[model samples]
Target: MDNSQTSILRRTVSSDTYKRLCSLWQQMAERKGQDSILLTEETLFSVNPSLAEKKYRERFCLLFSPEFRALLIGTLRTEDLLYQISIIWDTRTIADFVDRLSEESGQRTEIQCLRDRLQQILIAQPSNNPDLQCHFTLKLLDILTPETLGGLEQMYPRVSICKPVEDALRQQVTQERLLNQVITQIRQSLELPVILETAVKEVRSFLQVDRLVIYQFINESSAENERNHSSQSLGRVTYESRASDRIPSILNLTAEDDCFTYIPRYTEKYRRGLVVAIEDVEKAYSSSFCLVELLRQRDVKAKLIAPIVVEEKLWGLLIAHQCFETRQWFESEKNFLGQIGEHLAVAIYQAQLYAEVQQQKNTFEQRVIERTQELRDTLLAAQSAHQSKNEFLGNMSHELRTPLTSVIGLSGTLLHWSDRGSALSLAKQRQYIQMIQDSGKQLLELINEILDFAQLEAGKVLLNTKEFSLQNLSRQVLKNLQTEATNQQIHLELDCRVEPRHDRFYADPDRLQQILFHLLKNAIKFTPADGTVILRVWKENNYAVFQVEDTGIGISEDQLPLLFEKFQQLEKSRQRTHGGTGLGLALTKQLVELHRGTIEVESTVGKGSLFTVRLPNQSHRQLKTTPASKVEERVTFESKSIVLIERDEEVATLMCELLTAATYQVVWLIDSTTAIGQIELLCPSLAIVDRNIPDVYHISKTLKKLQTTKSIKILLLSDKITSTDWQSLSRKGIDDYLLKPIQPHLLLQRVSALVSSDQNSENDKMKL
Candidate 1:
């Protein structure tokens, strides 16, 4: 501590450095004690000669620098003296050597005792002031034994042992877990609106902000159901002391495109996952420009926005705001807001899933109801058809029986009086025969109509399509109706727009001819002697239009709609004179429609009527190839067993005669009651049983019982067969149906085909 050493120390510490050092020492001494003086460079050089030759000024400059001082005393406290001394000793050995010398002189006892006592005092002192702690650490280290310093190290406060810091961390973890639990419960228990409100309120409280809002993007193409349930508004007051009017409208600023527009850039720096943070609303340019202005007008300066991502997709935003000056948000606050946003995203996704499930349920219910109504309508239509058929049958039975009885009685009288002089004249006999023939024809036509209608209704009508000359078919119809037309003196005109020889077309020739014959017959029945019936044919588009125009007793407007309905005769009272089964036009229309064509009628009450038929002229290649002439001539019957099981004596007799003419060996039974026993005896090739016979089911069962008769072709003849009756027969394996009174030609044809086809099939089966 000489004058030269002092001058060297003074030169080492500049004016600014001296002032700073003096201030630090003065503060330390005031807080600690008057003996707590800083160790000068001269005292250090006196103990070590290498220090005296060294650059004192340069060395002192480093020691007094802010960086070095901060390292020595920044976080040091009275209890940290041993740690600071150890750090200072590591840089210089002179301090440690000096302390050892003092200890050897026996003068170290006084310093050591004082240091120990000061250590106790500092350890017991509460850590209220950081400066007092630093002062004690510097002073105590100057007096103590630098060796045997391990005891002093124990009193230092290491960062690892700070109880308050650990407690603070534990509290933060508990708060996060509790917050998470609350969010989960809120989402589960509440609807979207309630959940959103709760989330905003929680975020506002956690952030210590004035207000919070959840703004969701509105999809332009939202469904009707979504539009009704979507969140329209969500916000909450963070503080009860705050004014309600201070809660600015968040909607006025946010648009569909504003969310997540500027969020990605600062996500890494902040690490809080916010989309945008308006630290000062007035200074920053945001896409939410209007909203910023509104917020500023209401005195808001700071805001934190987090994007709501549902199902990993950005949905909208969660906005937390302050009404005062710009507030610096902490990392914890940002994290809390992010958690609220995440919970809200999940809630929104769940709500949407629930909505979808409900929509599907509603659609399924609507479909089921529609299907049920359709089935009901179809059942009603079937019931109506059944009732109409019953009425028709009743009316037909009376109409047919009256004519049949007269013909039979008249024929018997002629036969009985043939031997007497008063026998009927030849002219009268011929007239009676004609009456019988006419009545038979009428009955046959009625039976045919019923069969046709049944086939159409059952969806079993078959068309025999072929290429034929239209003119030739028309000529044939004219020839067949010439006698009737001549009797009525009605002129039948044929208008061939195309060449007669060039009028070739594809169609079901037999059905078409039948339709023409019926139309001509009707026209002749209603027309006067001088009236003309015209048949015209032409081509249009891809159809051939055939029109039958009749100058007859025309139909009225009220009667027109009923023209094509079954059993709907225009003149109920004059039905007999204009005799028909009233099914011709209906059958015609049905047949046309089956070909995917159409039939239409035009008429004026007193003038005339025109019936037009349009058939599709599909290309010949697309049409089914016509069967060979020989194949067409052959009728395929589905039965072969020939058991004549008729109940009516006269009808049975006629059937026997017809079968015999066809060379069919018949096993005749007068009643179906004994038919099954006879079928076993004869093992007949076919059984022709009357469906109306007594014990019909028993006969069917018995036939099924016989091994030989099990596969027999049983033809069921009836005056009429209903749908239920037909189904019953089908279930019992009845092969075919024949309506009576039977046509001799058709019967002979059916029997021949049935026997032949059965024989051929049996032969083939035996070979197999």
Candidate 2:
């Protein structure tokens, strides 16, 4: 091409437009035989020299230059002709060269580019689209002249049919452009509101409708659970675009809106791609008065609807209304709306997926934060425990060495005096010996504390529970701590509020003594000179409460939580003043919990501290049982045979031996579970039940209820039973309620009398 051709092209169109087109043509022409095409050298150069040199491409980039737009139609042209064309080729142009130079190259691909953060929002690469396999149809009308359009004057003639071609091209281009804009919006933003709003406005303008809207249905689960439709709001107009204010806006109309109560019952059909088109509302809904009234009120004469189905569910509807005059429905228009609906579905699915991903990201971040904080807390606790144990190690070194030094130093002095043959005065020698004994005891106590803490931590300690008097134990504890309290110049007081009846609570007597001793010793040790340390004991129902209150330097509030932690000593400055192993309070708490009891403390910084311990009565677990012990193989006298339900080992053994020595079969049982079975097997005529058995009352009642044992006489023994209570005791199936201190001879006499009474009653029955 020469300057003349370029000049002619410039005169036909803008200089920038023709120059860019020429550049693209030259580039495509240079890639010869690289990709299959429907163009040949002879055919391209024969009809029009300019077009002959241009290679064909189905897709082309259309860029608007400022100079070009100013020369041609500028920004003021709002008609369809001014709209940009995305693809200038159609199917008609492909067939013209199908026989000449066509190949089976139908697969084409384009990668969708997006922002980094939104890269995962794509469904897939949109390659292999059937729309890309067409030929070029709309030629450059700008470059076409009357002489050139004739195409060398022989094969084609008068090719300048500009207006008809331009209109057809414009229409197709506008529809494609609208769809491209929707796709662009979907890619650019994740906000559903913005996408839908932009889509509705653009669609309404393109289709020339009075109203366009997106009606979103409420969640199906929520709608089904709701009883009030007014509050439920089944479906509402979420997005709307209107041409004029005269046509009433149904932008937010729901099922509760006036005349909007009717819901279209075509969901199933719509989900399967059904498009609804009503040419005229009155004619379509002739018998439906409510729908007609609704349409009339909105000034809507025609309506077209397409369903936006997402993941095979009818998510919402895309609706367009004609309000001015009655309109005819066209197949092309219906299909276009349906295509738009499909695109909207894709956008909806993408937006929902993006939202879900973002939520998951947020949840994962929150969990990370929580887990990080937990790890930090665990680290701090471990460090504090390590530090506390370290402090304990240092204190223990001092504690262990002091008693050891006293033992070594005092014994050395005693040996020196003895070797020198210079015996000291008896008083002086006794004083030295007493101090050595005291130091040894102190060392032993420290060793025992460490051993006890180790055993408790290892879960090796077991309770040896028995009945003990609380008052006796408290007196012993006070006596042990009395000397220490006097030495410290502290006043010690004991207030026992336990009633005589409840004073004998059940626990291990030795451990109970140890617990009270340690508590009182602690009180006396911590009390300042002339301070008062009081020990209070009381019974509250089944629990016995022990409180130790001291008017001494009390604990601070901040130190209370860790006061019972192992090897933790408080007020480090006073640690040297009040010297001992740090395991005292920790050991106390462990012992309390070991008995299924709780210990609590209340204190003020400089005022006083009260330590309260509540211990539950465990009398039922006090006894050690010997189930079915020493059952004889044979019975000589059926009436003389007896079953002994006793908990005390010595008492049961003595009773069993005595009855056997009298030539009577005997079964001794401590566990009540096996008492009835053994008695029935032995056919015992008498059952001696002890009050120490937990279910002794129930045992007697059950034995009397049985037919074989109903005639058997029960002998009840209890320490507290009196002669006056026999009437009340006999009514409970006991033929005799004997008081305890049962001598061998006395037990035998009562047994003989009770057996005779039963025998006499049986004899009376036989005679009757």
Candidate 3:
């Protein structure tokens, strides 16, 4: 223990390395009940060595000094040699003793001393993989100095080999074999149960765990009808494994006591691909007695759960348990479970896709059968219509000649009487004029019927859908037919059962009026004097129903089916009582179909006939309506403003009055030149503009671009808007469009709806 022994140690090892090693050797020597021959730096620098500066230097060299660490590795030469010497001592014990000595003496100990120098070298190598490095090092050392180990044994025969290093080598080999088997199983098949069962059995056998299972959180129910009622109670014990006679099976159990209820809490823990390991369930879930009790029932003293994620959703669980006794779960086991869950999710997804494809195939076959029957029925109807068309042409030729001959003869007699200056009674001349007028009207009616039938046949009509008052439209049609109804001595009456507000619906109003007019006119023409014609309208579900009943000469059952056919009339003679071509009802039927509506007629042989029309209350382009009672009253909207820009004086005056009555402050601009200034000045919630107004699109663009007026809804009014014009108007951001001659009540309803809808949307954004 003098300077002579120090010189011997310094000659064998580096001076700095020997100093650090001496601190380590002394700790071991003390534990062995012997005195250390080496001196420590703490004892040498013992003058207030506990000062912060000296302590920092010691920690710095221990953790980060490359030069000092290099000297230690060079001195020990191999981690194997360091391990052999440590058995004559102990690395953990020496480390503990050095820390205690430093605390007691108030100085830095040799904390960085490489007592396990072989392990240190292996850790510093790339990947920190010691098995490959240890194997190669052992081979090289045996070849270079086979007798070196023999010399060490003679000095210290009690040296023990490191058990952990050997154990790690065996585990690595087992994991590699298991991983290769699993990957091959996954690649072989996509069946759900097969993939999951293989994973559970193989992973359990490799990890040497008592039990393993894949517990899934079932989001969908096996019974689809029960899904909405109670999906929370559903989960399956999908797959399971156990050691020989180690524990009872819990597979396929859907008992109420199942742990599926804990999925919500566990999902948060493992949603981000985390692994959870519970060494002891009692200790882990001490605050949650229910969770602990759930495990205890299954004799699970320890457990681990890993999440299976598919498409970024928590799909299910992969669980492992120690049934007989508490066991600690390792990082490697958790990682392997996660990999298995991922592969199983892929297999399950593929199975689901296959089931969907099979369902779609079945649905497609059923649709084909239904469509084929419809085509067959249509072909038969077409054959019957071919015969009726031939008869129509011959009857139409004679019908045309009679009207033409009357017009020519009556007009020539009047011209001859006037040119010859002959005495002719005023009453006779007047009668001749009346005959000419009636013939001309008959001729025009025939021509119009043909044109309408042709247009319907060629599919040339397009519906201009808009919200309009059905009650108001029907009244207008009846008013126009008053003269004809009076001359025919037929009484007209309206029986409206629809709510006043509900009577306003979306459809092609012009076309609807035309259908009503034709049906009413036909009723009056067939009905005798003192006969009554009644029009009834109501709403049921999403359809507006209209029925026109007349006390007329009713149709027979045999001829009723042919009533709507082209040119097929009950009286098919040239001198028929109807005195016209029989295309009216056919054209009316086609027009009803164009509006996605149906018309049907029921008649008794002599009592009366009832014609009913059902049209959808809403169109795709129509805004959804809330019930009238739910709407906020128009009187409460006195602060809102509207701008009316119409070149037509009468229409502008009418629109302004309607808007004003609805509690909107209206600014009426008759001239197109001043419309932009008026609309901007008013800053209205809505602007009603005539489509014919000069520079209307430019005005809409300007108003839309400005910050203050950008949100103002623009409703374009056009007398005849084509399909292309509608598209152009939509691009300019027109909110709603009204055809010219729109009813006053309909205009008010539309404006109120648009403004209210805009206000509601803005409120939603503010809430967000």
Candidate 4:
């Protein structure tokens, strides 16, 4: 292979070159008669002189063919070409050719005589080729040199023995390419199944095994498990590649493996990064009948098992099998298969992480979508309410002015007439006074309605309870509404569907009376002149049911929801027929609720409307306890609510479970971007934020800046914390810090402490 040792064999063989060489040979053969410079049958026979001429002449004649000559020339030495002399001829041919020549005479004289004859043959060629003859003679001398022949023999002592060198070298290159291809797939693909499938098929072909499989565990992988970790009862085959139908698939195969539990060396080796190559399972596992029998059943004569461990858990195994016969596994193959398993474990971990991240992403997206819809609905409601307020503003001005105008005008007219010293009829005076009194009463009623609604909204309203008779209450409400109903020509009826004794139940007499009077008045107002209005009172489930049903200009279903909202009215009629504000039903609902009661309404657009009021018809003593509801009705600080802004599922799950067990209301936010909005919405007692949040500082600062959220307690969680981090955190309005790797009891204690406290000091910090 060095410059001095290698011959400069310049191959000038082309179509044209072949033609010239063929013509030269033809001329030589014509002159020499069956003998030429090129190889001939007789020349080969001389080298193997002992051969039976008739029998081997045909075989020897093959060397003179163009195909053989081309193959021989292809083996010649060159810088770039591989010296593959073994492909055409081995040492036996060379030894025989050299040995036959030496048998005739002295070796030197024989070689010299042959070289001179070849030189004379080239020199005697009749052609205008002076330079060629000299160059040819020099190459002829070099070829006949003893040292060059010795060098060739030494460099390639025996071609037959070294034939596998080329194959082994090619195998190395192929193996490298195969491994790179598998790694590339892992890198490029997010689809775990596709990567695993392609890897197994390619690996099986590379290892030239009957089958390859990824034996993944159905049960969670653990190094501690003796029964499940064993080969005989190992995990299920998740992916497999088979050489042919002749090879049996071990997919879903299960066998009893009690012996594996007793002898755990196999699994132990796998954990230590060692491949368990079973050359002959039948022989090696003869002691374990279960393992041997299982292998036999699966047509496994040989096997290579490598563990796919991820994050120190024995996730599964990469297994290869030889089904036909027992195999002698090479060390290199064992190492490569183990390496594949390691790489596959990496892929599995990556894929699992990708799946988790995607799940988190999808969950966040869904939450965002749902929250967006909720916000949109809220915004619409707020806009609607704002529009109603504007309408009320205009309506209130008109409503107040009419009564004031009447009152002022009547009084002013009376005073003017008196001051003018004019005597008018007493009838006119009484009518003017009456008109002023009526207008004053109307203005007072509107002011009282607004004042009551304001008091209810401020949570200042308290019920003055009494056992009022439902019968009397119904009669009074009907009587109060009789004149109004009569003016509209609408019939008024009272249906008290209760025993007189049972009707005397617990309630505020005045508020209860007000509740009924409002319902009946509303019914009478909306009714057409000939329509009917009824006040129906009954007792059911120890509760009073006061239903005011009317055959009136009914309310549409869409407006029914708005009917109980403040400043809401049946606008279709507010401008034309009905008067006053939109607070009647809203105020009634509030008062009903204050007395531990409910109000429900059912209405048809064109037929009628029914408003049902249910109040607990019990005495004051009855409110001390209730039998059906086991839970207490009183509010306490234990009702403390928290907003958790942590994205890690494992950590969140632990924290949420603990807090919930401790009876705290927890709202989890996987999407950190919504942290501030959620805090503002819920206005929770505490917001537990993970420091991992990129905008944790900004979130806390934002919460502190908002008036509604300023008082909220903030608990910052981190995996690690130094003294230096606290200053920044404290400046950002982080009231407290708790380090992560969350401890259940400690996490609950910290959360409870934060939620219970009305405020947090900057120095309050807890570590792992």
Candidate 5:
């Protein structure tokens, strides 16, 4: 029935007139074996003889008013509970019909119930079909006494007139009960797979469809190892349902078939939570030939798909298919499946969170195990290093005291000899003086080695690269060491096999000298009397190689690796001939590595040892040879001002003397904290500031930004230059950086260059 008619009939079940008429109509319809049962005025009066008395027409009119007839007409539809209901109204009604009914004592109860029921009918005012004029059979029924209906009964009257309405109500109740049960089960299901499986089965049976399946879209996030392994999109049949006589199941069909092509379409719809329903797959997706073929193969004529959304992301799909024949999906079925997808999304989201938490737990446990092992290894290494350091310190104490004792004794003896000049020989006095000098030199060399090793360990060493003749540097090194070689009774020889093109290589000449000196001195110390030591230089590819070979007591295979270790000595005997602080070779390795080079040792015990040093033949951009004239010919700047911002009193005084000697106006600010004000006032051509000065970074930044000092050239001085410090100062417009213990000539040259560059820039701007 249409909604309006069904609502009206349902509402009338509580009406007295509707109840009385339904009883009479059912009785007559059963007797005639038909649905139509009309009650006319003549038949109604025969049933109730009191209606033929005074003002009977008026009485009928009161019970069958136009308002009542309109309500009945609006209620009765072609699909209504009642097939037909008519009321032929009598126009002769007078105003005494209600009074006549009131006067009947036996009918008063019936009339009062009718009056109350009619008053409670909540029909809309002025019905849409107000022109209807019908005689009310309800009026006669209202006037008839219950005793008269029992006395004039023809056969037994039917008592089941409201069966159609009852049946409709029952069906609605059943549908609601089933839906509630399904919803409760889904909510209570904790396992995601189980929930989805149950939902598909329930929905399939409830809809009586041929088949239903949940086609889940397994995207990268949902699939483990998808990103690391495969690039193809995938779909899996997570849940499926079927009838016993239905088409073959398409469950777990994830092969690279036609279904794979539909992933893009499914993903788009799932992202937007869109629903797709097809009455006939072939007709709706005709252009999707593969999809059509796949469905036909499965004997699926109709289909429905919905999205399962979890946390605003498309997780998967909920699909239903009708395989037996072409089936049109109803709105109600679509709504049911959509609801299932939503609940499933919640379950799946919870499952994914649980999985992620477990994964994190596993990862955290594995990291903890690895970290524990690392900490154990680090503890063992620290203990070993501590023991080695203690042993080295003990050895160092002995080494230092031995030289100091000799110097002290020899000097005291010389002092005593001079006091007793006549008692001591002239030759003996000269020998005592020579012994003192030798002991002092040995102590000084040991102290220097220790300091160099300390600096290397502390990462305080900086390279001073410059262009120099490698060939010339080697010759100078050999010449300086010739006396030492003679004293050791060893033959020292030079083998220069380097290419002419590589002879003039660029590097830190002084550091390179120290490295070569350590290697050659160690070789001479270990060589036997009359043993030969060779210093070899050659060019190979991009490297300039130097090898120091000695025919001496060579190292054992087990001790080769330990040769370059700090404070390590091969000879542990108390009567060993060779003596050293054991820091020379370690410092050599460090120096070589600082120049982006490597040092390797090759030795056979009781034969000889060969130490090879390979340094990259690279040229620095700021390379310059120390010209003999530049060192002596001092440049004078009579009026050009220079600011020296140094915190050290001695260094500042030394620089002040140097600048004044060169005829340059100098402003020495010991308190660097307020140097900027003096700097602005003097507006010097160049400012040399110590990098360690307090607030140096702030000072540099301010000086670069200040208008008064915008053109002032800045030079930074530090004990060691790190890459970070260099870049930071450079970004602040510092013109140059100079390492501490600065060479007088190099410092002056850098200052002159910076001031000259500033002048050139200003001149260029003026010309522009």
Candidate 6:
């Protein structure tokens, strides 16, 4: 052979038996044709006795059977013959071969050198290529570590270590180590499922087994001795071996139906417990049907089942099975599975606690919403009730005032008409007129109280601000009460720190006077016959103070708090004796407040009481004298078309007569209903209304609605008409308001002012 050809032959057959076979084949090929030369097992065995047993078995099968020879030759050319041969050989034969290689003095040094080279190649290769590293790693383990040999014997009893098998084993172990790290990280970082899953994958790869499952126990009923167990099964994983391209089946199992049998023992243990079963498919107990069925289908030979426990409760179980091969599980492996399961239990418990807290928060929020709605409803109801009370009071006041207006109006007419000589003697006529006047005054006072009370309730009481003399105001009040005091034989005294005429201040003069009048009148009404009333006025610290003291029946201590309440009579049975509405003091207090003043009362039982009124005083200009001509002109006679609407015929006639004497074209309507039509037809220059008419507001609204009565002046006459009522009537389009028992001169003045003002306003409108 040429040197180049010899070198090629030497490389192809470096081993002893291979070299002899190659030489024989070369000679045969040269003698005969290349086709005639055959590479046979006998030729290999003849040169190397070490290969004799393998060659004997191979040659016997190949020579006797043509099919076997063809198949062997075909497999050798296309596949790895060394690897295939190792796989087919028994584990004992391979182990013996490894042992012999270690003992032989001639090959020991060569083997050692090869082993070093293999390690260098493995270390040089990238870690990403697990198969290459695995091959070298297994080869080195076989050469250097007898412990590994023993372990492999126990782990894979029937298998032999060949190049490809060694590659797969190395890859699996490396993957298992990586997966174990991942499991540890998951346990440290996350909590349960992630750690369990990672651990299961690692174990599955290391053992070369399929069907790793995790089943969790759900306690359906938490009640003691009544706990029902349920299972949540995490399904299976499949494993593909390097020797076979086909994937083997892996199935998961859960003990949901037979939970009592499988879970009771684990619950009692309060720690990890394990079950290892071979041929679990044939087992009759119904611990886990899924596990059994899967094992049977995949031809599984062994399984390891471990419980997951947390805080003395059996949370779940992890099942790993070997499908294509039989495996013996170790104590360390079982313990690892239990630890992973424990992590899973803790995660589930935390999630449950979070859910419970969220539920309670939602419930509390719903209750708060309901309570808020209830409070809103109650507040609305209270507002509605208050509104109803105001309306009722307003209606009652209107009804009461109508009749009182007529009584006072007629009395005023009678007093005016009385002469020195009459149907009766002068003395008797004067006495009768005085009685009528007294009754009319009493009625008017009661009506005024009612009207004042109504105004306070409606929050419509307004003060008329003006500069007036406080001393003159007090004097005027005393002058008005002089006649009453004289008849009662009681001395009424006025005490002022400043001069009666010199004490000038700025305020609502009329409202202040009205409050003083009510207080004095209340003192007079409650005083006994011949009892004295004293009016005291003074100024202190920018405020004017007035005190009205009287010798009268005093208020009880218990009644003091309720003294200013509307319609509250101090002595219920004594109401008629006083001939006064209980609203006088109440109205007095409210009017004082309207003027930004305060009223206080101090009294003792069976002793006289004193009332004090303090008002903030502002400086006032000196009163200007009215011209004589202006005063006379204001009272001058004027002819006006006047309509008087009153409920009583006697009062209506008296009003008509008075207007007639004043040269007014008078139209009197006794019934208020007919007044609207009469006024509309007459189109009067002025209309006089008794506000005590039934449906008074409706009547007022109707009068306002009259189109024909444009620029027509209205004068509302009421025994109850005070400054507050006057303001309200003015807002309703009444030009002026007059109280019952009206003075002739004062009435004349208002009528003239209203008529002239109306004429001026109309002229302005025409110009516009």
How do the predictions measure up, each by TM-score? 0.45, 0.56, 0.43, 0.58, 0.52, 0.31
Q: Alpha-carbon error at 521 in model 6, in Å?
A: 1.4
lDDT tens digits by residue: candidate 1, 1-768: 222221111111123333454455445544444434333444345545465675443222112111112112211233422121111211122233335434633456544543454334335541213233234334432333233223333543242232343343343444455466656765566467666665565556656687676655554312221333334322222212222565655444433223223433332322234456678876764666665665667667888887777665456667777787788765556655676666667777888887888887896898799789999989987885676566556568766886788788888888789856587878999889998888888788778888988888776666667788877888889888988888889999888786655577877888888888887788788888889999988877557888899988788888888889886677654354655666788888887765556788888877788999888653343234323332221112112336787667768878887787665656678766566766665555677778777776678767876665675666778876768888988777676777777978777766676667666765575456
Off by over 4 Å in 4: 1-160, 163-169, 218-236, 248-274, 279-297, 324-328, 357-382, 420-434, 464-468, 507-509, 572-575, 595-597, 616-768
RMSD of each: 28.0, 22.5, 18.6, 17.5, 20.2, 32.9
Where is model 4 poorest over a 10-residue stretch in terms of lDDT? 62-71
* TM-score, cand. 2: 0.56
Give the per-residue lDDT digits (tens) of candidate 3, residues 1-768.
Answer: 122221111112223433444444344334334212233343435535445345322211121111111111123424333321111112233344445545645444343243234235334531212333233223322322325435544665553433443354345446655665666665676566777788889888887878888777674422321322343545668789998675878887553423334444445456577888888888977876676777788888888888877766677778888887888776667766776777677777776787778777876786788678778877876776676777678778877999899999988888888899894799998898888898898888788879878876775666666788878988898898888888888899998888886877888788888899889988988898999999998999768998999999999999888889787878856447765577878888887876657899999977889999988654332223322331122211222667788777668877877777776778777777777766655556788888888788988888899865788889889876767888888888787888767787778788988889766765575456
Q: Write the per-residue lDDT of candidate 6 for residues 92-162, one digit (tens) a residue.
A: 22223333444542445644543343334334531223232233334433432445445644754543434
TM-score result, candidate 3 = 0.43
Extract clashing residue pairs from model 4. none
Candidate 5, lDDT over the whole model: 0.67
Q: Which 10-residue window in model 1 sums to the lowest lDDT? A: 62-71
lDDT of 3: 0.66
Tell how far residue 603 is off in model 2, in angstroms.
2.2
Error of 2 at 114 (Å): 40
Over 4 Å off in model 1, which ranges?
1-328, 353-361, 364-368, 419-423, 455-461, 475-496, 499-502, 519-535, 548-579, 601-610, 624-768
Clashing pairs in 3: 79-117, 79-118
lDDT over C-alpha atoms for residue 102 of model 4: 49
Model 4, 232-306: lDDT tens per residue?
Answer: 455578899999988877777644446465565556666767788888998888888877877787888999988
Backbone clash pairs for candidate 5 read 87-134, 87-135, 88-134, 88-135, 89-134, 89-135
Q: Which candidate ranks first by lDDT, i.e. highest?
A: 4
